[model samples]
Target: MGTTTSGCCFPLRGSQAPTGPEVQLCENCKRLVLTEKEVIHMARTGMWEIEGYEMTDSSPDFPKLKESAENGCDFCLFLRNTLLSPEVDFDADEIPRIRKTYRDAGHQLLFHRAGYRMSIYDEGKLWLSFEIWIVHDATGDMELLPSLSLQDPPKPRVAPSQNALQSTTNLFLRQAIERCDAYHDKCKVGRDPAFLPTRLVDVRDENAVRLVEGFTIVGGDDASSSSAPKYAALSYCWGPRAHADQQLKTTDENIGQHLFEIPMKGMPAVLKDAIRATRELGIPFIWIDCLCIIQGNLQDWEKEAGSMHKVYGSAYITLCPTMSKSCLNGFLFRDPPSIVFPYHSLNGQPAGMYRIRFTRSWIWKMYLTVPHHPFAVDLISGSWVRRGWTFQEAALSSRMVLFGASATHFHCRTSRVTEGEDTETSVSLDDLGLFPLLPSTLSGDKLDEAWKHIVASYSQRNFTKHTDAIAALAGLAHRFHSLREKDEYCSGMWLSQLHEQLLWRRAMYEGISWGWFFNLLDPELPERVLLHAPSWSWIQRINIDYQYIRDSVLPTEPEDDGSDGHGDMSITPSPGLTDETLRLEWRLPGKSGDESSVVDRFMQFRGQELEITGFVARFPLANADKPLEVDELREADTNLFWKWTISGQYFCHTNWDFLSYTSWDRIDKGEFQHLRMLLLSSGRGKSSGEVSPGNAASSDGNISENGDVEEDDRTAFGLFLFPTIKESENGKFYRVGTWHSFCNGKGGFVRFLQYATVESLVLV
Candidate 1:
C-alpha cells in the first residue's frame, strides 16, 4: 500500500519505469533523475491519477512515455519486453531449478546485470521482484542495486561420522537450548528456570519419537518440586485442506492409543522432521499442538489451547518450518541454487566466493542471539505469517530455529542469524519490535506500547476459526494479567483501554461494496460472521485493520470498571470533564449478558431530547476525490471525512482503498449502533469557504494517548448527525450511510439546536 503524505497520497507505482541502478534507465534518463525532483515530487503528490480517478493515455506524461517506448528507450524497452529475453548472472547449476520454477507456472524468470531483479512473465501477468540496495559510486553519485532471489533451499549438513548425533543445524539447536540453561544459572537476569511447560511429548530417544503412555501433563513442579522435561515446540501452517480434511486427533479413546498407534513414519512430513530435529538436538521431548490437543473435545481443546502461551514461552526452543505450507510439506528440501556469490572489490577485481560462518551461531554461546537486522525476505511468504496462531508462537518463544526455503535462521533474544550468512547481515532482535511478548526484563510503561503492537499485528492476521479471535491471543492475553487486574479482558477490547479500543474497524479496500459490511445500511457482510461476541467488541468484528490506526502512544488508564465478573452492560457520561471532549462510562455486555437486549439490529439514544454537539471531520481519506457533502463540523478546515465504508470482518474503508490512512477516534461508545451513525456537515463558519465531509450519496466513517485535538479559530464546530439504527423491529439494521451538507440542515438540525435541551442519552 502506498503511504499518505501531507493530506494526500500518490500512486504506488510510477508513470514511467523507475530509474536507478536497480531500476532500468535509458541513456537519456540515466542522468535525468539525478537532476530533477520527479521521484521525490511524485512520492509526495502521488501520480496524476488516484484509484477512483485513473489517468489514461491522454494524461500529459503518458504521451512522452509512449513516444519513448516507440523510440526504443532502454528503460522503455525493459518495461515493454513482452517476449523472453535470455538473461543470467547465476552459476550454471541453478539453471535447472530456475527452469523448473518457470515450467511450474508456465512463466519465464529473467535476471538483469548484478542480479538486481527477477522478472516473472507469463501470459499478460508480470511480476518484477527486486529489493533495491543503494550505494555511492566513485563519482559520489548515488546508485541502486536490485538483489535477486533465487537462493538455494536449505538442506541439513550432516557430520561425516555416523556416530555423530548432531547435524550442522542440530548443533545450533543444541547450543540455543544449552545457552538458555546457562542464562538461567549464570546470568543476572532473574528469569525462572522452573518455568518449564506442563505437558510434553517425550521422544523416547534419537531412535524413537512418541508421547509417553497416558501422558498429557508431565508431572513435575506441580506434581513435585523436581525439574521437568525440556521440550521444543513446532510452528507451521496447517494450510488450506480438503472440505473434510482431517488430521490425526486425540480423543478419549485415541488418547490411550496414541503411544501404540502414532509412529514416526506415520506422522506428517513437518512433524516427522520436527521429531528428527528434536532428537538430533538431544532434547528428550517436543510438543506439537495438533498431535497433543484433542481436536473434537471442546473442553480438552480449550484447556490445552489456553495454556499454549506458557507451553510456547517456556519451551526450550520453537522450531519454525518456515518453508512448509502444511504439516505435509516438510522442512527439508533438495538443495537448489547456492546462496554464496562471487565477491567483487571496490575496483571491480574478481575475488573468491564470499564465505559465511555456519559454526558461530551454529556453535552458540552464553550471550543472547540478537537479530542484527530484519530478513530481506522471510520464509516461504506462505500461510505461516498469515495464520493468527503463528504470531503468538513466534512472539512467546525466546528462541526459534527457522528452516526456510532460502536458508536456515537462528533467533533468540539478542540476535538473529541467517544460515550461510555473515555477521554483518544478521538482524538485531530489537528491530523486531515484539511487544508485551518482549523480554521479561522489559517492563513498565513500554509494555503497554508493546501490548498495542501485538494487538495491531494480531488484528491484521487471519484465523481459520472466526471464533478463535480471543483464543488465538489467549496466551499473550493471559500473560498481560499482571498489567491490569481481573476483568480487564472484555471480549477483545481491554477494560483499561476501552475508550480507544472501540475505535477499531475492518480494513477498507477498493472495488468491494463498502456498504455490505457496516452495522447499519445495506449491511452486506454482517450476516456472515459468528455472533459469539457483542457488536461492540473487536472479537465480533474480526479481521480488523488496527495497525493503520495511530496507537503509538502511552495509554491513559481510565478508572477501572471495578465491577465483579459478569457485571451489568450499560452507559453513562464520564464526569468532571470541562472540554467538549467527553468520556463515556460504557460497559460492554458480560459474557452471559443478553446481547440481543443490549444491542439489537437497531437501537436508539433514549433521552428527553437531543441536540447537535459536534461531529468528527477527519483529514482527507488518502487523497480520495470523493466529494464531502457534510459541513458545519466543529472546527472544520482541512479535515476530510472518510468517503466510503466497505466490509470484510468489520466495517472498513481505506484511504487509497489499500494503503492505510488515519481514522476518526471519537467515543461513539455504542452511540452509532443500529447503523444510525451520522456525519453532520454545515459550512456555517470557515475561512476556506464551506467544506463538507462525505457525500450523502454514501456514508463512511483516534487520538493517540499523547495526542490531543487542539481547538482552532477556523469555525464553530459542526454537528455531524448520523442515524443510529434505521428503526428496524427485529433489531437488525443494514448500514447504508449518513447525510451531509455544506450548510446546516434548515429543518431538523436548526430547530433542534435552537429549541432542544441538552439531554443525556444511553445508547443501549
Candidate 2:
C-alpha cells in the first residue's frame, strides 16, 4: 500500500486483514482480537496500554476496588465477587458452565461481576489495554456486557537494591536490641524483657557447642522488617529439657488402681445373671462397695468415698442385679430416647423395626454406691430424670444408665451400710442418687422431706395403727408403680418386680416371727416334732409342756450325773383306772414327802389365757390376771380353754402349765369343771387330791375319778398344764374362746397345729 503511494486506505470487505501487526485492523478491533493467553499476560504484567487513555494529575481516574472507599467503581464489584466474598454464590446456570468453557478454550475469566469493569493488558507488545463494564437491570440481576474501553499503563515505582535492604534490616535489629535493654532496666528481674532472653542465652551457651542452628532477623528497610524487637536463640532453648521440671507429674500405676476385694455370699440369682451378662459384654470393672472396698480400713474407705463418682462415671457399664420381677416395672428398666426412632435404609427406605440407641454411660443409681461428701458435688440424687430419662423407660429397658435393687434386703443393706455413710458428702451432679432429676421437680431437701413422708406411710407399724397410713403408702406405691408403667426410661416389669422383692424382704426381715413359735419350745422333744409343727398350738402343747416341767418342777441343783435334781418320775405320768386319767409323782430336793404329797391341800390361782392361730399367737391382756378379750373373737359359741393346777407347798404351778394341757368345752360347762389333779407343792401352795369342780359333777357323769372330764370335744382344745398347785401365785395359761357365741365367724379359726419345747426353739 505504501509503495503504491495512494492517498486513500481501502477497508478490507469480506476478506481477512493481513496477519502482520502493522497491517492489523484498527485499535478497537485489534484489542478485541488478541489471544486470551496474550490478554492474561498483559493484565498480569501491567503493560497493556492505548493511545489517548492517559490521565492528568487532577483526573486521578484509576478505579478504587475497596467497597468502603468513597469513589468505588465497577472494579470494586469485580474485586468483591472474585476475592472478598466469604462464601461463593455464583449464578448457578452460567458461572460453572462459563468457567468450564473458558477453561476448555485455554482462556480464564480473570474476574467478572454485574456492573463491574474487567481489563487486560499486553506486556510483550507496546503497553496495550482493554476494559469492559457489565450492565444489569433494575432488579440487580446480571446482564450481558454493553461497552468496552482501552487505556495506557502507568510507569513502575523505584525501590532500594537488595543489598541496601539487608543493611537496613541489620540496623533495625540493633535498634530493637537497644530498646529491649532499656525495657529490661524498667522491669523486675522475672518480669523483665531480658528474662526470657537471659534464659534463652543460658540454654544456648549450654547447647550451642553441640548444635548448629540458623535463624533470620527482621529489621529496617527490608520488605518484611517490622518495628518490633527481634528474638534469637539456639534450638536447645525450645528443647525438651528446657521446661522438664514444669511437666505434669508422672502417674503411678497403682494410684487409682489400688482396689479392695470383698467376698459376697447370697447374691440373688438375677443379679448373678446380670453380672454374667455384663462380663460377657466385655465390661472390665465394677465398684460395688461390698465387692470392691475393704470393710475395716477408714483411710481406704475415705479414698473410695471420694472417688465414687469417678468410678461410676468412668465405668464402661453398670450392672443392675435386681432379682425381683417387680423391678422390671421400675425406673431401672427404662429405654433411652435415642433408641425410639425407626431405622433408615441407605437408599432412604424406611425400616420396619425401631433401632436401639446405645450409649456409653449406663447409670444404675439404685444399685450404685451413694456419693458421700464432696463426691456428691457432681452427682444428682436422682440422676436419670436429670438426664432426661423417664422412669417408664428405665422400667422397661434392662440396659440403662442406672439400675435399682429388687429386694429391700439388698437395697437397705447397700443404701444404709455402704452408701448411707456417704450422704454427708456434698453433691453437684445428678447421677448420684437412686433417681435422676426432672423438670418441675423438688429440690434435694424437699425430696428428702417427701421421702420421709413416703417412708412413714409405708412403714408396717404405722400402717397397723393408722388406716390412713395404709392409704398413703398405697398411694405412694401406686404413684411409683404408675411412673414405672408410664415412663419410657425403664420397664414396668422391672419396677413391679422390685416391688415384689421389697415386699418379700419386708416379710422376711420385719413381718411375722416364725422364730417365736419355734424358739419357745422344749429341747427334749424330737427335733422332728419341733420342726414339723405347722402352727403355734403344736409348739405350745408338746414342746412347751416339757419346758414348763423343767423350768417349774425340776430343782436348780445339779444331780450326780449332771441331771436336774428332780427325778425322771416327774416327767412320766402313771397309769390310772381309766384311759382319760393320768397321774405323775416326783420329789423335790430338801422337801418332805408330806409337803410334796398330792392329797394334802388344794389351792386355786387366778390366771388368763392367750390364743394361738396358725403360727401367730396373740396376747389379749397386759398381764395374766386381765380378762382375755379380742373384738374379733367375741362371737364364737364355745372356745378352747386350757386349765392349770399347782398342788405341792414347794412345787408351784406356773400359769404356762395351763397352756400345755389339751382341753376344750362349751362355755356353759356349769361355771366350773375339774380340769386336772395336782400332785405336789413347794413353799406357798398345797398338794391336793381330786381337784374337782367347785360345783357338783354334771348328771351326764362326764367327770372321771382322776378329776378330768371327757366333755364334748367339738370345741378347739389344746393344753399347757402344771400339776404343782400353789395358792396366791399368778400363773400363765392359754385359752382359746370367744365372748359372744352368735358371732363365731367374726374371727378366723386356727387351721394347723404342732408342738415343741422351748429349748428346741433357738435359731441355729
Each model's lDDT comes to: 0.40, 0.22
User: For residues 367-426, what per-residue lDDT tens digits would candidate 2 score against the true structure?
Assistant: 223322111211222222222112212212111222321111101101211121212111
Best by TM-score: 1
The residue-level lDDT of candidate 2 at 633 comes to: 14
RMSD of each: 15.8, 40.8
Off by over 4 Å in 1: 1-166, 183-199, 213-225, 243-246, 334-376, 379-382, 413-415, 419-437, 505-507, 510-515, 518-535, 540-764
Candidate 1: RMSD to truth? 15.8
Model 1 lDDT tens row, 44-124: 442222111111122112344457667644443432231112111111112243323322332222222211122222222
